[model samples]
Target: MEQFYLHLLVLLVLSILLRFLIAPGHAPEEPPLVSSRIPFIGHLIGLARYGNRYYVRLSAQSQLPAITINIFRQKIYLIYSPGLLAAAQRHAKYISFEPFAALAIRRAAGIKGNGPIVSSSSEKGRSSFDKQMKDAVHSVLLGEAMVGITRASVAAIKKSVDDLRSTEVDLLTWCRHVLTMATTDSIYGPMNPYRNREAEAAIWEFDSGLGKLTLNFAQRFIAREAYQAREKLVKRLLEYFEKCGYINASSFVQRRLEVERKAGATLEDIARLETLMVLPLLSNSAPSTFWVLFDIFSRLDLLEEIRKEIVQNALQFKPCDDSMGKPKQMCTLNMNNIRDKCPLLVATWQETLRLRANTASVRFVSKDTKLNDTYLLKANSIVQTPANVLNVDPNIWGPDAHLYNPRRFLDTRASPGAGGDRKRDRKWNGFMTFGASPWTCPGRHFATAQILALVSLLVMKFDISPVAGDWVSPRINHRSMALAISIPAEGLMVNVVTRKEVKGIDWEFQMMEGKA
Candidate 1:
């Protein structure tokens, strides 16, 4: 034992010397290298043990806008400084996300080689998949198309909530089901595969296994469940497409089908690609909805305040079709008013996302590039910007950066999170949930509408109490950075009681034109 200790001590001393004295010489022109105290595999071990929070610790010690670290000698950069992040985004063409997108999409779909991703491309290198998909999806997520989808999703939320009977239910699990059905209904019409229970289960299983599945190595044995789940979803979706499901689907689905079919992709290939679309539509909203409600309900004062705000601003009483024998009175929830009139609700939603979302925006340096007038990002190097670190940065989001504070938006006294275009988004000025331009999450508006509708309508109509009698947050699954919004490792069962005020009153939702 003593001999082993002596050898390890010598290695430790030698590694420190080499890391400090020698590693700097290798990439002096690039960003300052923050090497590990251990040799060769130190950084990799740190990431495995600490996950992205490792970057937070490194940022604290180094205090650099951007820092470089090695993973098995491969240079990877982490950027946190708001200014530097903005500067890097300005060079989006050079630090392209397309390369990573192309590769990741192919791997996730279990496709081989360079195939057209739902659209024909004029040139290869940085394939047009990301850009083409972005344009098609974003075009419908706003204007009239966005409203149409929002109404459909809102209606689904109503039906789901109406079925509630004050029973014990897993909050996160329930959120996932509600969102899966609602989002899929809006995006895929009535025939969305997720409307079936088996397909719904498969989607979550597939998502849980996405990180391993994307590794694209021995998936049948290693990520067998995820791989199998992907095929399951693809098979169902393939059937949907074969039956001309897009005919009755929203313009969103119709538009994507047009783009993919024009590319001459087989129905199976299009089904595989379409499965990818369901991921973003449902992933963030479900987890994020859980967090926002959890944050509010955990604090009774905030819960009452938000609930009151929604009732006063958005709620309406109206007559509806009879459930049995007589005309029934329905409570209409004006979604636009919920979004525009209820400041506390919107602020809470943003704050919850700020704290819970742990996303890393990764880009492949397509060409050697200079950034912040100091660092040289060499071609083939990897660039990462973890939103979690920036979201909690004390320098940008104020001293209570780590706390859940919705007032940060209402105060009108916060930093712009970065050098933000203040006018574009006044409330969520500092949020990194939806990233910046070029690669900004295209479904952001539609997502916001859905979250606000789901959460506000929920709290307004139901009183949720943890079955344990107190709100104890579940241990978060921090290991998987693939999901931006970190989910609870275990489910939290809560006893949901429909408020006396909402009992026997049918609930409906509307997105009034020019009001939402």
Candidate 2:
């Protein structure tokens, strides 16, 4: 017993000594300021509550390329600068996506029969899935299906205005319901579940599942809600597909199945489909709508300018019909052309996302990688590229970085992010909101287009103004923060009145306008 005890004591001492040896040390000339409280829990509290402030404090203290913190039992390296982020992506193998994949796998889908969500066993499967999603976005949905969606959304918007005599409804909830209807019906097929209370309940159940899946605990164990919702939604979707003759013809489902077969991966199709909806629909749709409406309410001058522009340009395309008629053909606005003509609305949306986004990205380092001559990262170290820090940093964006100014993007002479002159061939270093590498957002165009459409129309129709007294800012919630994309961290609430008609015929005919 004495001998065994002696051996255990020696082993414990050796382990302690080894940890001390491997642990990071401060330089003789300069030491890191405000590292995580515990070895890995650095800035956890600060980040959870006051995310922007946490980075500001840390960056002010030290110009270190990267700092380490433990987030949910994982050692995450926080990369503050664009240069370091560049290095990390270029040497991606050294920084694997396996850790991030573990979370996606256990909570999102399941333990991959093949490999991680980000890493595919075969490049062909990746290419196939990418092509499928891309085709689906630009194909029938944006083409033939968009006409119905636009009509429905426009109709909903008009009704929403009429329903609001109080002029103080929760815009966030209103936007969520409207966009959910517009998006799901247009792309996924005509199940019109938004109006049906039971169907809406199912959606909430599905959303609850998604909420659970996103939790830190869920990542460690299993996403039970997500899985259960998957079964229910899949049954519904399969029935829809069969009725629509899409079971065999649909490219999206076909591609998903192919990818699974090729990579030997497993995921409930409906769950993955719903997860996809959360990003494109929820991330930008509600928050972007709120911010744009918020801006219109707060800034009279800017709102007037945009409103006039939308009236002059978009309304001119399709003349109002005298007789009651179903829209045979929807007026299509060339988004690229709109961007060329009206720069203000685009800039407004960009600035809103910059200010609202709280987190950067979840980048997993590959095993055994050297970041630079000064630093080295071991295999499977999680890296966080805090774009929020980079976006609002005064040094980078000038002294008035935090100030709300839409002109920064509109002023072509100025750089897009920094509010300076436009730089040719802009790269994805400073702007990491859409993310980087093989895992970048596919719905970027869709989100941008939807935001522009909703905002452009609303600005044209309504002369929004802020309610009396101090403004009610949104309640910040971490889950609402964009883990990989910029979204409202919590329910963003605002009060504003719609643009009342000043004795003029609205866009639609008299009866149609009344119906609206």
Candidate 3:
């Protein structure tokens, strides 16, 4: 029996070696291959070791416009050339993003089988449900709809800021709590699920374990926390719907429910779908706010400059009488004017996104087709463009691409001959923080509004300092790859003091029209 087992092992090893030796080589028209040392499993190991950074490294090392990495039987074509990315977007029929979207909805939302959530057919062969959802989101997040949501969000944020009791607090946690409350209250109405602190905490717990959960690993052991959190949050969501939570919610939420119900989704299925919605609405803005704050506050000069910009753009004064019959001053900060008038603040926000965003835009090839009239792509293969690769490319972003320069988006004439006028335009084209069309984030406008409101209020009302004398940027939690936005490994400890200039002054926030 021992000899038989040894013989079987030897035969299996021989088979693997033979397979590697006779592996099919890449065709002349196909993208250049990144050679892997071990057969089948080498690229997977590399990905496991480096995470998304692996693709950026490969793009940097390879001379070709694209490279193909083989993981077991799957072929992932990683496009580095902007022209090829554009070509892929144009040829939307052959290389489709919907299949991947469907897979994500299934895995993350725990929806079983072919549901009506995905459109059956369309001109682009994409999901109609997705298009409806996108339309619904856009309708509610722009024009008058946007104004109403923004007004409500800014008010909620101001109230939370005014209610800050602790001088010293965890900056990330505080942002998450306040922003979660404000955003949810605005979108989900007064019956927001996150109003309960424990429920909000559970949602975050589920978010943290999302990578494992989506992979459908053994949930009882590997992703127990995520599993438990999902159950708790789902139960709450069902209750919210059962209690007619949709009555006062925004049109976006109402339309989503209407579509799902028409598709024969049960209360439980809708509850699961709502959990998916919570990710974009809640998870992204908090960390983005955290990174922006970290970048600005770490540099005192930048912080002071931004504060000045905020005051210049948004601050309005009111005259009043004090308790002792002395003249007193009060200020109201207008959120409507900030996005356009404050270039430095906008630049800081853009730079923070470029530095921290590491997600890839993924698509699956539905049919065999050629990309860029050069490379022949096989059917049923994956195609991807990692934003980190494009954001850090020296060709696209100049020599200082790797560094986090907050003023990158600002038009400074310090170097007149250095393409200063065109830097912002070029950078905008290369930046995929919100992704490209067809698959762009639907709630981007709302997310931007919420983030601006939160950050603007914090910088105006509070003076923040790190607990440690020197500030260290937290590492990105690469394990949470399932998330669209980067999550920090840990929260920052900071001391917050109310700004003296704004002390004893009644403060108010009003949302104005236009961007930001």
Which lDDT tens digits does candidate 3 get at residues 1-516? 999999999988996786566555567788888877777777778777877877877887896778898876678899987667767878888888767776677676666655566434443534566777666666776546666777787788889888985388888899898888887888899788767988888889988777777787677578888888888888989999999998998776887888778666778878988887767777878888888888888888988998899888888888988778888887877766777678788788888888888788888998878887898877888998888788777877789988988676676413223665565545665677888655677678777777877788788887788887679877777766655567788877899888877787777776545534
| Candidate 1: Cα lDDT at 146 | 75
**Quick one: RMSD of model 3?**
4.1
Report the candidate with higher lDDT, 2 versus 3: 3
Which numbered prediction scores highest in TM-score against the true structure?
Answer: 1
Give the alpha carbon lDDT tens digit for every residue of 1-516 in model 1: 999999999988987776666553446778788867767688778877877777778888898878888765467888877666777878998897766666677788886544567233455523555556677887887556777777788788878888878899999989999888988988888777778889999998888888787788999999999999999998898889989888899988888888776666677778888888878877788889999889989999999999788879998888877847787788888877887788888889888888997788888898888887888888887898888888887777777889888887675434444556553233343467887656778788877887888888778888898999889999988776678798888999998998997777877787767543
Quote model 1's TM-score: 0.90
lDDT of 2 by residue, 385-468 (tens): 776777776545557878888776665423345644334113234555666654455555555655666666555555544344
Q: RMSD to native for every prediction?
A: 3.6, 7.4, 4.1
Clash pairs for candidate 1: 336-516
User: Over the full model, what C-alpha lDDT does candidate 2 score relative to the true structure?
Assistant: 0.54
The TM-score between candidate 3 and the true structure equals 0.89
Instruction: Show model 2 residue runs off by greater than 4 Å.
Output: 1-34, 39-57, 70-74, 92-99, 102-106, 110-168, 192-235, 238-254, 257-280, 311-320, 324-337, 370-374, 412-428, 437-439, 465-470, 479-516
lDDT of 1: 0.80
